[model samples]
Target: MADRSFLQWPFFEDRHRELAKTLDAWCADHLSVDHADIDAACRKLVSDLGAAGWLQPTAGEVLDVRTLCLIRETLARHDGLADFSFAMQGLGTGAISLFGTPAQQDEWLPLTRAGKAISAFALTEPQSGSDVANSTMTATLDGDDYVLNGEKTWISNGGIADVYTLFARTGEGPGAKGLSAFVVPASLPGFEVVERLQVIAPHPLATLRFNDVRVPKSALLGAPGQGFKVAMATLDVFRTTVAAAALGFARRALDEALARVNERQVQGAPLFELQMVQGHIADMAMDVDAAALLVYRAAWTKDSGAARVSREAAMAKLYSTDQAQQVIDKAVQLHGGDGVKHGQKVEELYRDIRALRIYEGASDVQRVVIARQTMGAFLGGN
Candidate 1:
């Protein structure tokens, strides 16, 4: 009922259509995962998702953007936890899928795809949130291994990840070029989850500390000096997925509000019949559609062979996330007291949608990215 027709849009191909149909059926059968034990639930979801082959779309011989967006958007609409579980698998190992050596891919990707191994991307540190270049975590060469020392905060799947695609400072050079990406195993002696962060919405997040964690040189992803580029490239691929998740939240919020409005009574009539209420619904609907466009457009552009989708992804993330917050708020307003009531679906979404806007490149950071990209494009006479 929430517009399965998006797949019929020109942005998608036959394979994408097939994926949407299959995932829609899968979501219908699988209910929202219980989060009484969030960690266990996530682990279960990951295994289940992998078994179902949903993780396959995250990478491929031919990466299909429309299919990825369709899967993410559909999953997010059904259950946020499922979306997170699926997304992290793609993100944590994305660098390897895109740029890893054949041996590296064989070692990690199969396990990740099989849900036998959980993954995390360790990039943000206590001192460097959006300022990735300022990360002070050091990975010093010691014989055949790199000795890691520092912390990564705000990491998703932090406590549970079996493998981490970590970035650290390898040289004294300024800016991003001196950084490096490495595949770190959580079982290593010096790596520990220092502190588990309790967020408004429950998920496994933590501050990870690496004190002399030794990683084999074979674990290095890409080249030592190419870490920044690796990070950006990985983000460029996954950021659109973030927007897809936000769009799904908006869609669910709209659906929930519509259902409530049609059933709830006002002055001797249903709320949907009221003119002011109709206006809110109209705005919410428009926002949802606009967000879908931004999300899918970025996905399509990137998959269609754009070198970098920075501008498109920034717009999608900024607009979809920011709009999702507003759309969910409006839904809550319509539901009134029950909206904010404990254990309500919209209530949970209200909290969940907040972080999407803040993480994976915040709305403010996206504006800067868009403006700078636009300026560069115009100045270059493109």
Candidate 2:
């Protein structure tokens, strides 16, 4: 109903089309969980998604970017929190999926994939949200263990996560070079959720503290000085999915707008009868299609064996997120005062879309990445 035509694009295979159809049906039935208890809702969503086998693609050694994008887009269309839960599962354990030792992967991927355990990615510090080089969290090597002492804020699934992929300074050098990644369990003696952060959309976010929490050397994800590489590699795989999620929100917003325009009467006719309203609808549809193209282009480029689609992914995320904000704004304006009211789909979407533009590299950050990549590409005579 919401344009399955995109699935037929050359970017996707038959299996991907089947996946979209099957998951859309499942979401319509199962994703309507009560959000009165937000954390509980997210937990149940994860369990349901995992039990349904929708989470299988997340833990595979060789990830398919197209499949990840497709799943996120579908889940986000139905419910944003469902998207959040699934994305966190992949993101929190991404380093393990990509670079963990066989034993490390064996121990955690099963539980996370099965939804028996939740995971968090601990990268951002209070003082270093966008500046990874400024991270001050220390993980000192002491014999067979690394003593972790630091804080991570704005962590998704913070209080509820059973495990965390933590990044800390290990003194290999300075700034980003010295950072190392580790697999940290929440059950460690010094790991604590210092404060639960309440954001506009109300997901389970918190600030985590580690006071001399010592983990075995085996907890390291990659080489001692490879945390920055591990984190960047993981992000390269997941960033495009963020754009897909934004596309989903925009698609839903378009659907809501269309329904409202056709049914809501004004001045003795349907609201869409006005030429001005028709212009808004046209702009919204064009934005949706444009965003979809960029989103899938990045996914396709990655799946086609590009080593790193950082430039493509950044472009997709930047364009799709910014356009989605504009598209959703048109939907909100078309709905009149009803759009601003609590519990409205448009209102919820307004909040949900805002964070996408800010997180996983902000819109401004993406621009910088794109510009630098473009400049380097040109200078290389390619």
Top candidate, metric TM-score: 2
Single out the weakest 10-residue window by summed lDDT for candidate 2.
52-61
TM-scores for the candidates? 0.98, 0.99
Return the lDDT, model 1, position 345: 89
Candidate lDDT (C-alpha), each? 0.90, 0.93
lDDT of 2 by residue, 116-207 (tens): 88998999999999788789999999999999999999999999999999999998988889999999999999998899999999899999
After superposition, the stretches of candidate 2 with alpha carbons farther than 4 Å from their true spots are none
lDDT of 1 at 323: 95
Q: What digit string (tens of lDDT, one per residue) describes model 1 on residues 1-382?
A: 7877677889888988887888988999984678899999999999999898888776555566677778888899999989999999989998888878888888888898888899999999998999999889999999998999999999999999999999998994788978999998899998989999999988899999998999999988988878999999999989999999999999999999999999999888999998999999999999998998899999999988998999999999999999999999999999999999998989999998989998889999999999999999999995
Look at candidate 2 and tell me the lDDT of residue 235: 89
- RMSD in order of candidates: 1.1, 0.8
TM-score result, candidate 1: 0.98
How many clashes in each structure? 0, 0
- Model 2's alpha-carbon lDDT is 0.93
